[model samples]
Target: MAKKLELGDPAPQFDLREDGGGTLSLASFAGKKLVLYFYPKDDTSGCTMEAIDFNRLLPQFTRAKTAIVGVSPDSCASHEKFKAKHELGLTLLSDETKKMLEAYGVWIEKSMYGRKYMGVERSTFLIGPDGRIARAWRKVKVPGHAEEALAAAKSL
Candidate 1:
C-alpha cells in the first residue's frame, strides 16, 4: 500500500483519459490550483450527488482559481454517459487501471453487509499551484463537501 499522503506532500501524478475524448494529467494544471476528488463509481447515488454538487460549485471554484476534476475506476464511456445524464460541468477522468487511485491511497478495502471488497473511499485533495497538497478530506461526506473544499481553496 502506498503511504498515506499528508499536508504538503507532493500530490500524486496522473495521466488519464477524460470523459470528453481528451487526456487530462496533473501537469495540465501546472501553475494552477486543483481540486481532485475521487469517487467509487459513476451514476451511483452518492457519486451522482457529489458530481452535481461539484458542478454547481464549479464557478465558485473557478473564481478561486481551482479546477475541479473527478476520478473513478470507470471507463471513459461510462463517465461520458454519467456526465450527460447528470449535466455535470466538471471533468471526469477514467482510472480503469487503478494506478492513480492507489497512488493517492483512495483505493482500499471496504465492507458492505459482510462482504469485503476493494473500492474507492470517497476523498478529496486540494493541490496548490506549487504541486503540493494543501488540504485533504478522506472518507468525505457528499453534503457541503464541495463548499468546504472551495472555502479552503479560496483561503489558500
Candidate 2:
C-alpha cells in the first residue's frame, strides 16, 4: 500500500527521460510552480482527454509561470507518439519503471471488472516554488480537472 502525501510535504524529486529525449528533473523547475500529474496509460480514453485538456490550457499555465509535467509508465517512444498525435505542448515524462509513481504515492492496486492490478491512480500534485506540495488531487475526474489545476497554479 502507498502512503498518502500531505500538503506542505516536500515534493519528491525525480530524473526521468522526456518524451523528446534527454532528462527532466524536478529540481530543474526550482523557481516555478509545477503541476505534476500521474495517469494510468497513454492514448487511453480518459488519459487522452486529460492530456488534451491540459494542452489546451498550456498558455494560461505558462503565463502563470507554472510548469506542467505528465507521467506514465509508458515508454518514451509511446509518450512521443501520444504528444504528437494530440499536439500536446506540455512536457510528458516516461516512468517505465514506476519509480516516480511509487514515490508520489500514485501507484496502487486497482480493481476493474472484478480483476485486480497494480497501476497508477489518476492523480495530480501542485508544487509550489519552494518545492513543497501545495495541493493534491487523487482519484481525479477528467472533466474540468485541467482548469482546476490551472486555477491552483495561478494561486502560487
Candidate 3:
C-alpha cells in the first residue's frame, strides 16, 4: 500500500538521475513551484500527448515560475530518446525503481480491456514554493490538462 499525499502535505523529497545527465532532487527546487507528473509509460499515446502539451506550454510555465518534471519507470536512455524525438524542454526523471511513484501514490493497480496490471496512474501534483502540495490532479486527462495546471500555478 502507498501513502497518498494530500493538499497541505509536504511533497516527498526525491533525488533521481535525469535523462540527459546529473541528478535532480525536490529540495533543489525549493523556491520554485514544481509540476511533478507521473505517467504510465513513455512513448505511449496518452503519455506522449501529455508530454507534448506540456512541452508546447513550456514558455508559459517558465514565465509563471514553475518547473515541470515528468516521471516514469523508464531508463535514462529511453527518456533521452523520448525528449529528443519530441523536442521536449522539461525535465524527465527516471523512476525505474518506482520509489518516487509510490511515495506520491501515482503507482496503482490499473485495468484496461479487462486485464489488470500495476503501473503509474496518470497524475500531476503542483508543489508550492513552500514545499507543500498546493494542488493535485489524479487520473488526469491529457487534453487541456497542461493548460489547466498552468493557470492554477499562475494563481498560486
Winning model by TM-score: 1
Between candidates 1 and 3, the one scoring higher on lDDT is 1
Off by over 4 Å in 3: none
- The candidate 1 region of ten consecutive residues with least summed lDDT is 57-66
lDDT of each: 0.95, 0.93, 0.93
Question: Considering summed lDDT, which 10 consecutive residues are worst modelled in model 3?
Answer: 1-10
Which candidate would rank higher by TM-score, 1 or 3?
1
Q: After superposition, how far is residue 134 of candidate 2 from its true place, in Å?
A: 0.3
In model 2, the clashing pairs are none
Candidate 1 collision pairs: none
User: Compared with the true structure, what per-residue lDDT tens digits does model 1 show for residues 1-156?
Assistant: 899999999998999999889898999999999999999999999999999999998988988899999999999999999989988889999999999999999999999999999999999999999999999999999999999999999998
Query: Could you tell me how far off, in angstroms, the CA of residue 80 lies in candidate 1 after the best superposition?
Result: 0.5
TM-score of model 3 vs. true structure:
0.97
Candidate 3 residue lDDT tens string, 63-137: 999999999999999999998988888899999989899999988998999999999989999999999999999
Clashing pairs in 3: none
In angstroms, the error of model 2 at 64 is 0.5
| Number of the top-ranking candidate, with lDDT as the measure | 1
